[model samples]
Target: MSEQRVASPRTFPTAGEAAFREKVRGLRRWGRWGEDDQRGAVNLVTPEKVREAAGLVRLGLPVSLSRAFPVAPAANNPNPAEHYLRRRVRGEHGEGSVTDYAGVNCHGKATTHLDALCHVWNHDGMWNGRDAAEVVTGDGVTFGGIEQFADGITTRGVLLDVPAFRGASFVEWERQVTGEELDAVARAAGVEVRPGDALVIHSGREAWDRAHPRPWGAPDPDGVYRLPGLHASCLDYFHDSDCGVVVWDMMDAVPNEYGVPHCTHAAIFALGLPLLDNALIEPLAQVCRRESRTDFMLTVAPLPIAGGTGSPVNPIAIL
Candidate 1:
């Protein structure tokens, strides 16, 4: 399939990553919050911040940014979600009430979920630079579990619509969403990625998946997962902005130009940034465009699962 490549205002990251690597070297914020900081950037979402986010709701409209759960098994979803229903039968009414249960394995290509700080690891260690073993026990993670967000995450949500900015249907492999592109999109949208903002980068993943159906996380001829994802170069932008959380429709382009594994995911380790993965962003983009604004009051409440690594979430973008 030949995609009419479009021009970008920024440089593509595929050239070389000497600068990207240097950014990674200086991106660790292990003790930035504190020695035992369970909530990394969430601390940025202070009560005052939440109140400020609430003020953004001029339209009183909400857009869901989550994908339906228990996705069927496909090339991308190896572990299909489990769902079943049951009813209490009554002679006259046939049923008193209906109940359904859903089991979701949220940490992968298929589910829209929040990634806990303990989700990823690097040579420097987990969030706050703790040892992986110290964080994860036999049963579940002892530190930085999904439950940390039980109080909920309410902040200003900013959308950086890459496809719209580039006048393309979706992000292409040749022009990955790089850090410079992020800056460009934010500037184009006339929004600043202030601290504690739920920065969402819409790479048109839903449209791209619909247009080019393939295996999830499938590697290419280069033996690397090629998806429309944020390039590794974005680490500098993320670190510099000190955004509260990093949310994306396309997570990371693996074995990126820098040859780092899940390089963009380094935000989990380096910046202590919570990552909201597999978000259904097409609707959000539409709402933003319709409303003529990209900022909204974003709220995400994680299921209170004790010791769980992460939880399936239905993130809400209230406009």
Candidate 2:
């Protein structure tokens, strides 16, 4: 048998440039905030929404929704987080200190991170039609960087526990989760996804990865990686439902059925939507199960990097 040709990352407009461009135009949120706005969809998280979210924290139980920051290299993390001791126990003070650093490349497959609006580009532009070349340079992104989120994200969170609904430890590897599956999970969980909610989809990918280690590089000869993730169609639901943020166990599908590798990022770019990728949703799942509730007060703060494209975040959900 001959090997099949897989789509390359640079392959423009897998669904044809004309149709993809029109789709992007239809969903694009450029000027949704204003001609010079930078916060994008997150602007939907109003003060009223935050106050409402605070009301949901009846139990005041906070559960961490982030994966352990990967500090060592692994099969999945080619460029791991770095750490150094700036000072150690010395002198009468016996003071100690350390510094930690990581590049975006350190985050892959399993790390929990937040994607800033400048993290992706579509049609050679960014959110609000900002020129990619001008906004993003070798120096770093001058606009739409993580600094836009300095005040932090505080809103109501709705967890669609797909694994729990399916009664499985994890979704099948390489499975695509679309609006249908999301609706089913939400219904089964007895929850409704409301506007301005921080929607989180849990697929149990991290648990599977921990139990089964494999060489993590390119896809297999079959053109699919052993992971589960969101399908591009999910973006429509996100936009129609007016969700402020989309958090997922994994951001992109291993190998999408549509053959459009960048569909998720492209939709995110067009819609000015921020993404929370590789979130550790299992803990949240457990907490929801224990409390018999899925809605909570979710809060996340990204590092104030003026020109950074994304940030390593530790989100918390309080019930």
Candidate 3:
């Protein structure tokens, strides 16, 4: 009988050796993945990597999610000369329009706006950690302001187009959107949500706007402007998942109704989640329609103002 070569004495690593081996293996396993997946992995070596990973672990991850709309303040002509009082200057140079923009209301034309953390205040008056009243100075300036976020936002973004699933034109506001509706939309969009992602909802209102531009100066008839929104329960779901931001096609989470306040705003803002309101959804919808993709890269940069309440954002979606 051929003598079977005896296997070398099985050497068990010592406790220290085993732990060290595990450390090395863990490093290789965690650090070898792609930037997106390794965003929150252990053994993230650099400070930036650590921060990215921590944000992912904290907020889950974001999807490229935002829409661009053409918003003209005053909804008339956005031309500077038209909106602002202009003085014709006669110099060696040809005549030019010098705008006297002292009294124009910037807030009215803030179509692509970010809801600063200070935008909402609980009845008790606490904001983040500081008292709400404290953050807002006597003159109404806020601290830890949205200006801090002016550096273009970068993160994973997810889309949930509920109206698309039903083949409906748009979601009507104040309609008590249910969790079941959300699940159906996810199914239609083929999106699998993870924690910490910015949730963007497209209600098809933009398409409606394109088809029927809100009459230049006509007031939106009562109840004619309603659109679908996240149910109150949906806010609970996102809060539990550690989502950082929510971008919507409409101005609020729920439709504007005579008797109802925006509960979605109350629920989310109370938890420190910033909002991207009145976002344009046409581009996002087009991308979804063309490529059939529900995810992409979303980049939005808000104008940095020292103590401003909110800022207009130029949001871009990279497919």
Query: Which numbered prediction scores highest in lDDT against the true structure?
Result: 1
lDDT of 2 by residue, 132-230 (tens): 878878888888998899999999999998778878777764566787788888888788888788998888765666665453333555554434567
- Global lDDT of each model? 0.80, 0.75, 0.50
User: What is the TM-score of each predicted model, taking all chains together?
Assistant: 0.89, 0.87, 0.63
Stretches off by above 4 angstroms in model 2 are 1-18, 92-107, 215-226
Scanning candidate 2 in windows of ten residues, the lowest lDDT window is 1-10
Per-residue lDDT tens digits of candidate 3, residues 1-319? 0011211223211233233233222222221233222112111123443244344333233333332243344332242122356678787888777765432222222255676655654344323334666678865455546675666465556677766776777665446455567666776667766544566777666565555556221224442323345555555554454555677764443222212334455532345566777666756776667766676556667777676566667666555
Candidate 3 similarity to native, TM-score: 0.63
Tens digits of lDDT, candidate 1, 1-319? 0111222213334544455556666877878888889999899999998999999999899899988775587766768899999988778867587899888786887888898888887666778877997778878889888898999899999999999999998888767788998998899888988989889889988778777757435444344355667777788888888899988888776546654456788888778889999888899999889889989999999887877778888999998
Order the candidates by lDDT, highest first — what do you get?
Answer: 1, 2, 3
- Backbone atom clashes (below 3 Å) for every candidate: 2, 0, 19
**What local lDDT score does residue 108 receive in model 2, on the 0 to 100 scale?**
61
Top model by TM-score, which number?
1
Q: What RMSD does each model have against the real structure?
A: 5.2, 4.3, 19.7
- Distance (Å) between predicted and true CA of 308, model 3? 2.0
